[model samples]
Target: MARVKRNPMRGGNKFKLGVFGANADGCLSITRHPDRWMADWDDVLAAAQMSDRAGLDFFLPLARWKGFGGETNARHISYETFTFAAALSGLTEQIALFATVHTLIVPPVYAAKALVTLDHASHGRAGLNMVCGWNQPEFDMFGLTKPDQVYDQGREWFEILRRTLAGDAAFDFKGEFFDLKGVEGAPGPVQQPHPVTLSAAFSPPGRDFAAGSCDCIFTTFTTYDDAKVTIADFQSRVDKAGRQAGIFAPVHVVCRPTEQEARDYYQDYAVTRTDDAAVDQHMAMKKNMSGSHDPAAYDLYRKRFAGGAGSYPLIGTPEQIAEEMIGLNNLGFGGLAMSFVNPKYELPWFLDRLLPLLEKAGLRI
Candidate 1:
């Protein structure tokens, strides 16, 4: 049999680009905008088709079981990631599709099979974002407790998945978190050893886990200098683990014909019409349950959370947004997963306006 090619996410453009959070309502913005992303099946399909045609690098979905309580509840209405990826795999031809999986929520054997199914369904365009579970409320809903050795459990989880995809033969397994007999998966992923894996991690342990297990790391930062520091820190960890992992950043954008118009709209949706209650709920939960941000960010970046779930923001005209993207590329980000207030309306606009700038900057082709 011919060796399967690498997942599109593994390499390509100097700066890869992806559409993030399209599976959830309101994309990433906790806002009261009348036309905030509805996340209906049609809307999700439209966004995926648009992104695929635009030659976007990938389509990444968030794994959210419950909504941050508030007026809009932000991501309350959402599609399950694996199913979302599978559906899109049949519809889109080029863009890679990722399913963000919380290791604790799905068994490793199940995850391995599902990913393989997606890989076959997409003909090797599938990818995985492995998440060590966070969000206590969501955990509560599942009647599961956050294990003390959270990342340790995650490590074991990935090991099982790795072994499961190794071949068709069943094997007994023992571990701190898992014990199984005759464990195995058939029809391993189309991508050789396994499909590409990424993790969004911010804390040291999280970074270490990602560096050790993932092919890519997704991280957040407050400034260019902050991002620089994060890159250096993560690179050190990757080196220590004797692995090479690409670093990706997530950003929320507000682009318009003029910088002022962009800023005004950003203020209108993210501040004036923001879903204050949902942002509060999200902030408090994330601060207490997750190490997904800097400690100072909770208080210092409330508007940021409202704007794009605490991701870095790019608000300006197409040229300005493109420049900011180039700046991130300079800092060594392998790619960006981006969200917008209303992707149904804005994504096409962005493709039409900003893509040319990125191409001219040599970030994409």
Candidate 2:
């Protein structure tokens, strides 16, 4: 309902870059290694600065209500995303600040107001990523139960928030999950008509929700070839729905001087010296929530557990890794979101060394 003229992340760049979940516990690397762990003010602010100076486009955080228990307590103590984004907005420039929220937990009226406030704090640089509640234990902790129809509930939640942000007159809405009475958000978002919104949806209903309600969509693929089919189909679906949205691919990147070096880094950090307890707990929760119908689906998520939580691994020389992302660009991917184990240590190298190569290839500005 809000008028979105041009996507901030896609203003001129064909393939934009964003930092995913770096503000929350290494984005699920599930390790205790100090090098790869994060969730402190200094670490988060530093990474945001690097992304800002390096011309990265956005910083998206995870909304983890609870952690997967292990020696490390994976994702156990995440800083709240909304507050984090609001605070970080004061320290950075250019890069968008994204706060993730669980639709089941955040009341639509309050959630809409919070987003508008953050957009003002960022001077119109705020965005939202919405997720249906998963992790049954996480819900139980909040004295709640997982909804029977998660996507349907989320769809209703999104509609309420959308109208709350865009409506010119006082409005009342009644949906399956929400009911509002003569309420309107005032001093609307700094970004006319509202800040960017994103949804991470894969199934048919989920994809349809994204097509109709979001300015961006976050998703993943098993491989680059698989991406061509998936991205094209999703794009067509969005077009048919009369919405032009960007689908940003999520991936784990291990770029070094050579393929062997990259493999060695991945093996040392994410595999060989992996945090077994955390991985097991994470995998169990994923399996319980996912209900993987086929063996193929199970194997795929199982591998994602071992890797960095379902992100396609881009491991090789810097140039090789850049080229791999370029391939996603070829597949019609609007952009890429990265989850790094040691973003503070590694992201600068990407900006200094790898980004130039990508720019030369015409993937970035």
The runs of at least 3 residues in candidate 2 whose Cα sits more than 4 Å from the true structure, single-residue gaps closed, are: 1-7, 32-34, 291-303
lDDT tens digits by residue: candidate 2, 103-159:
888888788998988888787788989887477887777788888788888888877
TM-score, candidate number 2: 0.93
Query: Once model 2 is optimally superposed onto the true structure by TM-score, how far is the C-alpha of residue 61 displaced, in angstroms?
Result: 0.3
How does each model score on TM-score? 0.97, 0.93
Model 2, clash count?
0
lDDT (CA) for every model shown?
Answer: 0.89, 0.77
Clashing pairs in 1: none
Lowest-sum lDDT 10-residue window in model 2: 1-10
